[model samples]
Target: MSIRKLAVLLVLGGMAAIPALAHGPHSLESMAMPGATKTTSSSRATVSPAQLKPGKPQAMLIFVRDGRGRPVERFALQHEKLMHLIVVSDDLTFFDHLHPQYVGGGRFRVTANLPASGSYTAFADYLPQGGSPQVSALHLQAGSGSTASVPLTPDSPLSKRAGDLTVTLKLDSGSIAPGRQTPLTFFIKDGNGNPVTDLQPYLGAMGHLVVIRQSPVLTAADYLHAHPEDQGGHSMGAMAEMHHTHGERQQMAGMDQMAASQKAEPGSVSFKTVFPGPGTYRLWAQFQRNGKIITADYTIAV
Candidate 1:
C-alpha cells in the first residue's frame, strides 16, 4: 500500500478501537505508589443508568471491598473531603472534580449534572480505613451525541493571559521523555509583565496541576491525579524536589517534614512527573493571585 493509504488505515484502526477499550486511567495502587502497600483491586464503583442524560442529574454508586468478598465501610478523609470523583469525557475535553457523601454500609452516592452527551470516565479516589488508597473507575455513556475532538490552538501557548496576570509553564526542558521524571513548574506575572511577589494561598495551597492524557496509551493508569501532597500517594515528593535549585537532596529531605498547609510562593510549585508513554497530553495549571484564581492550559508531547 502507498504511504498515504497506510496512514489512513492506522488512523481508522485507532478510531475503531476506542469503544472496545472504553475505560479511564489506571489506579494508583497498580502504578506502584511510594509508601503504599499492595493494593487489592477487588472493590468496584458503579454508575446508575450506565449513562448520563444531558438534562438530568446522574447518580454514582461506589462500594469498597478488600481482596476478599467483604464490603468495606470506613474510609479516611483526605484533603478535607471524603471522596473525590473525577469525571472526564473520553475526548479529554470536559473535566469535573466532585465530592460524594458516604451514605452508609460501604456505599457512597454522588449526584452530578453533566454538560453534554458523550463517552466519559468516572474515577473514585479515596483512602479506605486502615488500608491503601483506592482509585476505582466506571465507564459512562451520555446521550447519543458524538464527542468532540481535542481543540487545537494556532500555536502551542507557553503562557496564558488573564486580566493583569500571566501564567506560564516552566520546565527544565521543552522535550519530555517516557519513563523519566520531568520537573514541571508554573509562574505568574503582574500587569507590568514582571514575576509577581503577591502570590498567596489558593484553596489552602500554593498552586495545583491536573494532568490528563489526550490519547491514552496505558490502560491501567492513564492520568496523573495529584494536589501537591501524598493524599493520593507519594507522587508529590518527586514533584517537590524538582523545585530546589542546587541542594536537591537537602530540599527533598525538608519536604518529608513539611505539611500540606505550608505557604507556597509563586513559581515554587513544581512537580516531578513521569510520563508512562509517548503521546499528546494536556496540563491544567491553577493558582491564586491577588484574591483571584487563574487557570491556564498548556499542552505537551512525550
Candidate 2:
C-alpha cells in the first residue's frame, strides 16, 4: 500500500486516537545520551527485516561495524548503547521502541509481533568508530504472501544512503489562503533520484513527519482544539477550527492516537493533514535503512 492509501484507511477506520504500545526489555533511560558529538565515524552498517507469520512475534536483526566493515563491540563506550532499534508501521500505528539484545559481538536483536501484514520501516541508530551518531532506514514487507526476498543492497532503490534523502514541499497554488483546505504533497527521493517504495514503518508509521508553525502567533487555541467529544478520532476539524489567531504554539494533536491504530497490511502508506494557521512551518521526516537513521527537514510558507 502507498503511504497515502494507508493514511486514508487509518482516517476512515476511526482509529486515529489510539496510542502506540511499547513492548520489550529496553527502557528509554538506557538509550538516552548525555551529549551528542558533531563528528561521526565512517563505518557503514547494515540492517535486514525478515517476514514472519502473521499474528506471530517477528524479529529484526541489526549488525553494527567499524569503518572497515568489521562488527563493533556490543558494549562500546563511545555511545550510551551500541544500537537503538525503532519500529513503525505505515499508518503511524504500532510504534515500538526496543533495545535489541546484543547476542555477543556487534549483532543486536529485537522481538516484535506485527499486528498484521504490511510495509514497515526499521531504523537503526548507532555510533561508528571515531564518528558521531548515525541513523539508517530499511524497508520490510510483512504478510504479503510473496516469498520473494527483497535484498537491502547499496544499489537498491529503497535503500537510501546517509546523504541522499531529500524532501520538497509544493503547494497547489502560489500561496495558501486562510480558512481554506490546501493540498500539500512531499516529494521524497534518494540521492540517485529513485522514488522510495519499500518505506518501512518507523515508530509506528510508514514514516513520521513533524510540522511546526514558526510564527509566535500560532497557539494551541489557534491550531488545535480539545476534541473531548470526537470519539471517531478525527482531530483535524478541531485543529483547523481553533479560535486563537496568533502568538501561541501547540504540538500537532492526535499523534499518539494515530500511532496506536496501526495495523499491518500490504502496500504503501500515506495520510492527509491541514495546517490550522498560516505561517512558516518546519517539517521533519525521519526514516532508517542500512542500520542507520536519517532525518530530512524542509521549511515551507503556508
Candidate 3:
C-alpha cells in the first residue's frame, strides 16, 4: 500500500478525536516553554474528502501524536508559529509555506491547493512542548492520473528572477558538499540591475531557506529549514528580536522599512546549513520586499 493509504488506515484504526479549544492563537509568552527532552513525536495527515482532485482545494488535517499513540496537546513556538506546514509536489514544480490553524487537541487544519494531480509531500515542522524540533512527512495523493517523476537537474546559473527582482545565490566555498557547513548568500537586485537595499523583514527574520533532497519518496530526514546568520552577515536573530520587542502588528506597519539595514551589506541575505548527503537538493529562498513575499527556487548539487 502507498504511504497515503497507510496514513488513512492508521488514523482509522485507533487514533482518537480531540476536542476543540476555545482559546485563540497562542503567544510565545503564554506557552511557558520547557527544556527539550528526548521524547519523540509523530504526525499524520488526512484529506477531508478522502480523495483530492485536480484544480480543487481540500482541507488537510494534521495530527501530532506522542510515542504512546496519544495526541500531543502542548506545543512550543518556532519562528513565531506553532506549526509550519510545507507542501510541495514530488516533481519540485510546486511549493507552499503554510501555518495550520490549531483548533484543539493535536489536530491542525489547513487547505491544500494542488494545481495538478500528482503525488505531493507535506512536511510538518513543529516543536512539542517537552520535545526537540521534529519534522514529520505525510504523503498525500490526489486522483491518480500520471505519476511520472521529474528528473532532478542542477541549475546552470545560480541567479534567477523572482517577479521584478533578481536573486543571485552564492556559496562561500563556491560549491556545496556533504557534512560541511555551507554559507548560502543571496544577492538581490532590481530589474534595472541596481542593488536592493531595503529588503523587509519576513517571518521574524530577514529571510527563510528550505532545502529538500530529491528522491523517489521523501522522509523527514530529507528536509532541512534554515534561517539567516547573525554576525558578519545578515542576522535573523537580531531581526526576530526587534519584531518581538515591537510586536508583529506594529513592526509590520512599514513595508518599506528595513530592520537591520546598516549592519549587513546592501542587497544581500545569507543562510548556512550542512547537506545530509550528496544529492540534488531543491532550495526555496523566501524574502519580503515592499510587503510582498518572493520565493526564488534553485536546484543545487552536492
Candidate 4:
C-alpha cells in the first residue's frame, strides 16, 4: 500500500513503475541530493504563441534537462512510447493522451488543440537514460475571455452513462486511503443493465484508465495515469499491429488518441491503485465497443 506498491501496479511490476510514480511533492529531498538518479528543477514549460488559440493546433516543446540546465537526450520506452503526454483542462472537462516525437536535441514536439478557451495543463511523462522517470507539468493559457476559475470541489459521481454504456465504479474497499492500494471494480453495461461482452482490444490492452487530480497539484498526488496493460498481458488492435511487422507499437507520434478495449467477466474489470494524497479526483475510463471508442467520466473523493 505504499507508493512503491502503487507504482508497481502501474508500470508492470515495482521495478518499472516505482522509479516513475515516485515523483510527488512528498519526496523531493531524495531527488535533490547529489548523485541521485532523478533531477530537480523549478518546473516550467515554453509555449509557442505564448497563448493557445481555441480550435487551433498549438505547438508545445518541453525541454528535458539535467540539474545543469543542459538538454538531456535519450528516453527509455514506457507503455510502447518514449513519452506519454497527458493534457487536461482546468475544469477537467478536456482529457487527451498523446505520444510525442523526439524531434531534436532534448525537445519533444506535439501539436495540441483545445476546443474551448481556458487554462490547460500538459504533463510530460518520460524517463531519461541514466535518470529516473519524471512527470513534469507546464501551465498554458488559451484564447481571450473572462472565464471564471473552474471549481475544484470533490464530485462523487459514481455512475455515468455515455451512449449505450453505463459505467458504475464500485470501490470494494468501502473507504479509500492515501498510500494504500484501493481495489476499484468497473462495470460496463447497457441501458437495460445487462453486462456487455465482445469488448475489443484497445492500444494493446483490455482498457485504459486515467485519473487526474482536481485543482491541479495541491495534494501529494496529482494527475495520476496508467494503462491497464500494453503488451503480453492483453491484446492490441489489429490496425495498430499493422504498423509494425514485429507486432509492436504503431508509431504513435503526433496522435491524441484515447485508448480502450476488453473482454472478460464480459463487462467487469478490477484494478487496484494508490492515491498519493487525500483529495478529489476525476476518473476517465476508455474502452472500445462495436469498433467505436467509448469514454466514461466520473469523480471520487479519496
Candidate 5:
C-alpha cells in the first residue's frame, strides 16, 4: 500500500488505542499551515543516553512505519517524500528543518553533531496515508554534566522590537538544578498591550520552541531541544493534559480543513525559552498570523 494509505491506518490505530494507553506526556493539536494540515502528538519518544554519545557528530536515525511496524515510503496523497524531519534542542538552541536522504529499508539518517551534554527533542513531520500531516516529539540525551542552577530574574527584559511585541526571559525560581523542572514564561501582547488570544497554532502547537547550546557555529553536536509548551502561559508540565481541551480539538479540526484547502498567511511570530545549563543558547519561535509565516530568533546567556 502507498505510504499515505499506511499513515492513515497508523493514525486510526493510534486513536483507537488511545483509551488503552496511559495518559501520554504531551498532547496533539493542529497547526494550520498553507498546503498542510499539521497535527502534533505531544507524547515524547525518548532515546536513552547510552544510545547517544557526546562530543562527536552523531547520526540520528528514524524510521517512518505503519501501525504494523512496516516502513512508509510515499505520502502527500500522491506518494511524495515519506517524511520531513525537524530537529531542535531543549533550550531552543539549534534548528534544522531537514529532508532526510532516504536510506534503504524505510530508514532515514541525518548527521547531527551535539555540542554539549543535555537533552534534545526531535520532531518528525509526515503525512499518514489519506490523512493530514502529523508531528511527533522524540527526546534524546547527550553528553554528561549537571544543569546550571543560577536563577534568572523573573520578567527580566531580554529584547524588544517595533512591532509592539516585547520579549522577556524569566525563570520559575531564582535558581534551577539539574533534572529539576523549571518554569519559563513568554508573555506576548499586541500594540494595544492586550494578550494575543488569537494566537494561532504553529507547527501543531500554540507555538514551537527550539533551544540549542551555543557554539561558535551551529551544529547538531551543540545540544538541541524542541518542545511545545502550554498555550495558557503555564509551564511545560501541563502539556500532556492540554490535548483534551475544547480549544485544542477545535484548532486541530481547523488545521486539517485549512491544509486540505491550501491557504497561506503573512507575518511572523516570536517567543522565549530557558536553558538547563549556564552556557549561551539560542531560540527560534515560529508562528502564523494573517496567513503569513513569521520566524523570530534570539540568543541569551543562562
Candidate 6:
C-alpha cells in the first residue's frame, strides 16, 4: 500500500488498506517510502528541572541516535523542518506543535510550557538522512504527583471555532472503521457564516493534521500525522522534485499563489488517512489565515 500518491475523490479503488494493528514505527505509510532503511533510528527527550510546575516553561533536549547507539548527525527536511514535535497532556486537553532547533551532535532543543501539572506525551517525528521516517514517543512528568486525569470522550459535534473562523469536519465514510483509508474533509466559514476562500499556505501545505489515540500511556503506535492532499493531484515524489528544482523559497512562493490560481472549492480541504485501531482519538487541525495560525481540535471514535 503506497501513500505517496493522492487518491482522487471518485477513485478509491487503489487506496491503501492500512492494517489496524500497524502504527508508529511499523506504520505501512513510512515503510513504503522510497529508500526506507531496515535499520531504524532512535531518539530520547529529557526535560530540565525533572519536576515541572503548573505554569512555567521547561527546557527539553532531544537526542537522536542510530540503532547502534551512535549519534545520528544528519537529517532530512520534512514539512520544511528537520523535526516535528507534538506534545499533548494525558487528559487530551492540551496540545502543542513545536519545532526544536538543531544544536549539533544530533541534539535538538526547545522549551515546553505545560499549562498544568500532569503527565504529558512528546512525540518526536523526524527523518534520518538515509533512513525512513521515524516516530519516537517520550515521557514527561510534572509536579511528581499521581498521573490520573479525566477520561477522554468523543466530541458531540465536529464543528469548532478558532478565532473568527468556524471549522467543521466531515468524514467521507458514514462511520470511520479501522484499517480503512478514509478521507477527512474540513470546511471553513467566517464569523458571518460565509465560506472562507482565502487560506494561506502553511508549512508548505494547505493544512496539517495530527492525531493521537487515547491511551493510558501514549506511544509511537498511537500517533499519526497527515497533510492536505495536493490540489494538482501530484504524487509526493513530484512535489519533492518541484521543491528541489525550484528551491524552498520559490516553491513556497508558487504555493502561496496556488489558492487564487486553482480556484478550488471555497474553504474546503481534505486528507486521506487510516486509523490503526478502534479507539477514541483526538485530532488537531491547523491552518493559517491572514498570517495567523489557528488550531481547531475534534474528538471522534473509530
lDDT of candidates 1 onward, in order: 0.53, 0.39, 0.65, 0.56, 0.43, 0.66
Tell me which of candidates 5 and 6 scores higher on lDDT: 6
Q: TM per model?
A: 0.67, 0.34, 0.77, 0.68, 0.40, 0.78
For model 1, residues 1-302, the per-residue Cα lDDT tens digits are: 11111100001101211111113564432332211112124332223345457757756555544444345667665544567777677676677777888877666767777678776666666666554455555555677765655653322557777667777777655557888877776667777877776555543345566676664222225667544543233455344334322223433333441443234443445555788777777677766667777767677776
Show where candidate 3 strays beyond 4 Å: 1-50, 172-175, 232-261
Give the winner by TM-score: 6
Summarize candidate 4's per-residue lDDT along 1-302 as a digit string, tens digits: 11111110111111221122235774432322111122123332233333567898765655555444455667666546677777777677788878878776676767788778876666667766544556655555677652343655554557888797898888754659988867666789998999887666565445667787775332123766544422233322233333333324444411212223233355775455677777677888877788888888777787
**Error in Å for residue 94 of model 5:** 8.7
lDDT of 3 by residue, 219-252 (tens): 6778888877764453443444454344453234
Name the regions of candidate 2 deviating beyond 4 angstroms.
1-49, 74-80, 145-302
Worst 10 residues of 1 by lDDT: 4-13
Tens digit per residue, CA lDDT, model 6, 49-142: 2345668876666666553445577777777878888988877889999998877777777787878777776777776665566776655556
Badly placed stretches (over 4 Å) of model 4 are 1-45, 145-157, 216-220, 229-264
Ranked by TM-score, the better of candidates 5 and 6 is 6
Identify the runs in model 5 with alpha carbons over 4 angstroms from their true place.
Answer: 1-156, 162-164, 215-277
lDDT by residue (tens digit), candidate 5, 222-271: 33334333333333323322332322443443344234222212122222
Q: Is candidate 3 or candidate 5 better by lDDT?
A: 3
Top-down TM-score ranking: 6, 3, 4, 1, 5, 2
The residue-level lDDT of candidate 5 at 126 comes to 55
lDDT of candidate 2 over 1-302, digit per residue (tens): 11111100001011111111223543211211111111122222212223445567755455544444344653432112455555545333344545666665455666766667765544454543333334444334467742222221221122223366654444455446655644444445667676554443343233444444443221112221112111234333343233112102112223332342233221122334566766555444555545455565444555
Model 4 steric clash pairs: 206-261
Candidate number with the higher TM-score (2 or 3)? 3
